[model samples]
Target chain A: MYKGARVETIVSISWETLLDGVKKGNVRSLARIITLVENREPGWKDAMKSLYPLGGKAKIVGITGSPGAGKSTLTNAVARDFVARGYTVGIIAVDPSSPFSGGALLGDRLRMRDVVTLPEIFIRSMATRGALGGLCQGARDIARILDAFGKDVVIIETVGVGQDEVEVVKAADLVMVVCVPGQGDGIQALKAGIMEIADLYVVNKADREGADEVVADIGGMLDISDNGGRPQPPVIKTSALANQGITELVDALVQGFESGRNADSWQAQRVKEEILTLVETEILDYLRENWERTGDLDKAVEGILEKQTDPYSVVDSLLPLIREASRSKETT
Target chain B: MNNKKIRVLIAKPGLDGHERGARIIAYGLRDAGFEVIYTGLRQSPEQIVSAALQEDVDVIGLSILSGAHLSLTKKVVDQLKSNDAEDILLVVGGVVPEQDVASLKEMGVAGVFTAGTSVSQVAQFISEQVNA
Candidate 1:
């Protein structure tokens, strides 16, 4: 009978039902709630509003790099180190969602096989889900939930520092940029989008050929760009494949976060971005809810698709309609 | 033998980003008459759930080589139940130890496919679960 209930009724269950599972540290329920929120289902806003006050307790760290830069291995090793030190860790791996079907082939979690079994650790793999950089919001929200759930550290490892990924890592307290030897375009790519944001740069696959040269190149780039605003970000060499330099990387992460250098400004920025994101999400939700009822936006969409109306014109017309609707409702 | 597409979501939880196995599985699943939604590496529990929900998937296959499977999987299960999405089948394949299989199953994971398990076995299991 419970399984046969309507979705709206099922979702309408008391928050206690959901919170009970979350409080019990039920991972399945947590994952399910995250999915609901990530998918932006009806009534998720109310659920999150309920869960909001319980957040702001976890320290979030972001890791980004070029593809094959050993970002995953570094994340795994770092998480293992944290767990060994008796700290609970939550990890969000940001993957690219399939645009065609809006599903994902997420496999990054396979890298941290050893530490994932620990009771104190939680890991989730996320995809873009048809929204560019939406995974960032998803990661941030889940991290908040994990923080509220009592996690000590939350690591958000993105799928390379593309424009969207850079925005995601900007939500972190500290960001680590990972690079590897022999990746010709990596340094260039990092400089283009990721180099500016890394609090720590890790040279993974350190045993590979030309590791020294790659390190030197990064050093030269940093030297020229060292603005002396804060301490020049540290460049640490690591070999995640061999498990070398993992402790040092962890130590660097602790020092970076605890020393309070990257914490303050980032937190302020994160809060600001979070507020904007919430507003945006709310507006989108409102639009979606009223889309069918109004038929105005649908007509606009159709016009845009058919090139009958420009986007600005559509917006110009829709804004007045929305304003009038709100005004009329208020008067009534 | 209707060739209806089997929609599958391959997700990674936590920071473990070794995606070769997931990519291989996606390709293999796609080749085997399934529409594999290969989310390219690193995902959160919420993102995976959203994917499963919006995609209206038949199976949610998680590939977690990370040792944090218990908590991660638990988080996912919790999300599903709360969203009233308990009907969607959950399966996991990765570097899981034999000892944890029972616990994962107890946590509502329908199938625990580990290393050395055949892709065909996973595909077949999914077929059985969804078609049952």
Candidate 2:
């Protein structure tokens, strides 16, 4: 019995089969392939190359906010509404990974129980995986996979911490910055970083006291910031627990996407960023691999420890090797 | 690579309201350098299996204290087989008797940790099984 199973394992699942399964909307296949690409498993690049063209159909929306802003609840409400509108939704909730253990406690999906049982909704919880920008590089790839898997909308939720979180949300077509009452000082501090990334400002937990004040604070900030004469992003109040203002939020999101549909320049800029990121990651990986293969990295570290060569001089010495590695990779 | 951490999904099946064991195991596994995805309470076999697939977890540790271990484990194992994911290591914990451990093993559970099993012991079992 185990012999046949061992043989099957030896012959890994083919890319064609996985791609066909994704096209047919098989959730298992979609899930499996997403894991493959997210881990950058062997042949992952080929898989992504095949699915890249099939994406861009789904409307990508990003929800980001402070740790206690009820981002997950708001995301759940928005996704539920999207499903009710006869659209399939995919959600990516990102949590921080532990630097010490290289592990993550992905509890965001627990808060999203409301939409988990819905057949039209697929929720995936991801760790930042040591990526600096609040999201792993695989996030964009996973979003594309979800888009290709036939979801009409994909929501990327990140814990808004710093510039990294803002950079993560910039990948979305519509970005919502969530604020809750009693976090006035926190929200005010974030206005310089996260506030600028919002295409819409959502005052979540509107049932709490000072909800109106928070909304007003956001409005006041918008008045002060010069938005280059463009219409200010609308600030909407929502109680995710009570499910208030979700419809209005959805409508605003749809209108936002509609109005920005013809903005090819913005889309081109996003693509440009994505391409640069991809190149940077690939080149770095190649350089590391080459250095490791040649024992140069260890030698360089030893030299630094011995104070034989300064850090800048070490890098200068490594530059020629890195260039040679890049050339070799290009030829291959 | 050697640095890659193992991912585990600790799921509670069959409407078990008790979550202390699962929570402890989740934290323990995380501290042991495993990315643990905890599915909270009251998960169906389908939900558990779907999560394991989507997360690409190397191990699935089901915490069932509702006396439905045999049936739930069978359903989960069957679902995993149907999804071509039988290679995933499966474990069971919570209120299990020695007599039923063999039965669970027969149903494809790799290990069983009853009450009083240390978190490190459970983590060690999982790490050994997955790496093996």
Error of 1 at A76 (Å): 0.9
Local accuracy of candidate 1 as per-residue lDDT tens digits, A221-300: 88888645777888888999799989998888888767744545656776788888865655555565677687877888
Candidate 2 at A167: error in angstroms? 2.0
Q: In angstroms, how far off is B75's CA in candidate 2?
A: 3.6
- Which residue pairs show collisions in model 2? none
Error of 2 at A178 (Å): 0.8
What lDDT score is found at residue B60 in candidate 2? 90
Highest lDDT scorer: 2
lDDT for model 1 comes to: 0.74
Candidate 2 stretches greater than 4 Å from native: A1-11, A132-136, A186-192, A261-264, B1-5, B81-84
What's the DockQ for every one of the candidates? Answer: 0.10, 0.47
Instruction: Encode model 2's per-residue lDDT on A135-224: one tens digit a residue.
Output: 535678888999999899999998667666877876788888998999755365355477666789999999999988888888888999
Give the per-residue lDDT of model 1 (tens digit) for B1-132: 011345688878788988878877786675566656555556777766765654446678899998889989999998888766777788888889999999998988889988888877887887776666
Superposed Cα deviation of residue B74, candidate 1 (Å): 20
Error of 1 at A172 (Å): 0.7
